[model samples]
Target: MVRAPFLFALLAAAPASFAQQATLSNGTMHVQEGTTLRFTGPLQFTIGPAGALINDGLIDLGTQAVVVEPVGSPISGSGVEMAVTATDGPFNATAPGGLGLSLTTNTATGPITVTRGHLARVFPEGDPSIARWFRLEAPGGGSAPVDVVLSYDATELNGLSGSAIGLYQSTQEDGPWSSLASTNDAAQYTVSATLPAPWDFITAFDQDAPTASASLVARNGVEVWPTLTHGPLFIQVKDGAALEELDLFDGLGRLVTPAMHQRSSTFASMDLSGLANGPYFLRIGQRTTIKLRKE
Candidate 1:
């Protein structure tokens, strides 16, 4: 995915902010999870204890690679693999290392619109065997039913014939994963179910296969749209409370504090008294914020 914007308070607690590296006009810049962008320069976004930061060149991170994105540059990656090694930790990462996929663009001139309709999951954590857990959740704690269609590029791997693949969903990103869709072949799949509980879809491979090498796995490329959750509001939540705050930005993926949020479960209403009416994303986070547009 492209470098997104500020963090949503909801994402404040998540550790391990995945970093993405790409070169541009001004050297290398480090990026975190919800960073928004227009990098005419090289950037590497990394997330950790101190939070996410953008650096303008290659700094030696443990794993991962050094990707280059030149102006009008065509980006590509091969021998690309995610291997989750079986360790005594909470997650199992195997060979090839971790799962990962490169998010690129087809356009270079104007702004990019990436909605749930343009989400792609990159499993660069390597191979997740018997220990890969999945989770999902809706923004603003909005329990409204939304439909998300997830697809993956599995053409890079082989030997996954007859593998039982299914997607799981939930209101939270860490709970019992409910099955959304399933199949057994080599092709892109889609699910049309509504996640009333705020959800995410997980595609799983061989559940009990002993041979780790032959299990077929892939990343997610999904399209998500909130159905009954339509909005053109400005609001914020302050400890289970709803109020009006103006320090939010939208999908533009740039960082610049605007206003402040308050205590509200559904910060969906606001008064843009002095501001112009258009489209903006209400980004709430320590860094990676949830984006809601105001029109």
Candidate 2:
């Protein structure tokens, strides 16, 4: 019943290396804020029934396997609790090949494990850009919703831009994958989403398709360029009239205001970097509403 904070609590021998495997039979393990607990190698790390992990820091399991055994004896009907908080920092868990998870969850009924790999090579229902998957397993599920942040590499985009990426989840490995309302950080190559319940499989997909170079159209003395823009959108007034008012609407016609917008007498630009990839309607002053796309 030793209650040490981190790695020292488990391995009292030599420095943990790639050849060793750490097993926790029982007791609560805590990873304090700003600290990182990493386990690397081909061996498996197991946490038995009487064991628990409370992580508020980063846990890097580079190509390693972590098994959280189920607590058959549910204490007061609550089996085992493993709370992972990822909102405070960058991300909590990271695996090989650019798969990461910043998960927020409550108690679990059974074993919980994370594996990196693709469930299917090609999913025709969603983005065909990338095919990597991160599978999280929790038998009976948890209490609160889980926030997930997945990072990716530009090479894996399959010719798609990073800003056009989003998260998609499916209960099974095969078909019927649904898109999640996620925010993409093109600079960091990360996509984030909040799942109401536990999902079996999650992957990154490109929600916006590439448009032809001729999509840019100008009318009524108002001009916009590179219709398929990655971030900054430029607007110019051909007649040199004040741009007056400007507004943006999403695919559903929902009004969305850009966080970074600058305007002068006849020229203006909006930073569409934080926006999702889709078709949007940009309204300029009165009587001029041009259609555009954001990637």
Candidate 3:
């Protein structure tokens, strides 16, 4: 059976704005070839093999992460392409490999506006070797920050235990590059940081090791084992106080494991076989949170 492509069009003639949250549960939301769609709140959309989101307008994702999922599509493997024309002012584009590139306001206080025809050029004579390059303009006299998140595939990164990645920012795009503070989420294959200033171009590459290591401390007589693991995770509490509640959350801040009660025991384990390979957080009691990885 042939499935017709689902299309949601926003024409320039109509010129609409979504002040609250909206979702495109299933289907493609096409921002017509020459039109614009402004989103003040969160905008969630799903892209499948037969669906796509082509934006040629000003989209403001606000403070929320734009969730992009591929249903029955190769988006998670090969990735999708988002072209920002020269006229498109300040737009953000995130790829399947967990790469989020965006040009937003300086304050980081307002919405990110992407105007049409705002083409970002590769720095330093447009190097052909660079896999991806983007150019962003600072809002007039004020400066803006360029944010970059380098995400890797868990299977390919070897469970994020021995892999290292770095994010570099450059003003000339080819001259000298400055390194930024990046947090590695081993479980989920992502390293991200925000550049302090507006640079010509920002890029990410692998490193020998992470700049900062995950800290393991004994809090409230409880300690989590194998900060980095490819299988089930173990937690132990020295004092035989039963855990009031336990919770597990994915990198995107979604709760993967529901709150559960545990009897007074020194040791407990949770199987991660059902969850996708990535970084997760295990919260014990009410405050202690530990990072865990699944391969």
TM-score each candidate: 0.26, 0.41, 0.35
Clashing residue pairs in candidate 2 (N, C-alpha, C atoms within 3 angstroms): none
Residues 1-295, candidate 2: write the lDDT tens digits. Answer: 2246333224434235434446666666665556666655543455666665555454565444343334331111111212222122223343322234555444332434555442223443233635356666554553345677876555456666778766766666653345567788998878888765756677765555433452445677878776777778888888867776887877444678886577788888888889988766577766355556687
Order the candidates by lDDT, highest first — what do you get? 2, 3, 1
Q: Candidate 1: which stretches are off by over 4 Å?
A: 1-139, 155-163, 170-176, 181-185, 189-193, 200-295
- Residues 32-74 of candidate 1 have per-residue lDDT tens digits of 3333333222224223232333422212222332222222211
What candidate 3 gets wrong by more than 4 Å, as runs, is 1-4, 7-43, 46-50, 54-67, 71-162, 172-177, 208-295
**Model 3 C-alpha lDDT per residue in residues 64-109, reported as the tens digit of each score:** 3243434323122111233222332343543311124534333442
Candidate with more favorable, higher TM-score: 1 or 3: 3
Model 2 segments more than 4 A misplaced: 1-99, 106-111, 118-129, 141-143, 210-295
Best by lDDT: 2
Sliding window of 10 residues with minimal summed lDDT for model 2: 73-82
Summing lDDT over every window of 10 consecutive residues in candidate 1, give the lowest-scoring window.
109-118
Cα lDDT of candidate 3 equals 0.44
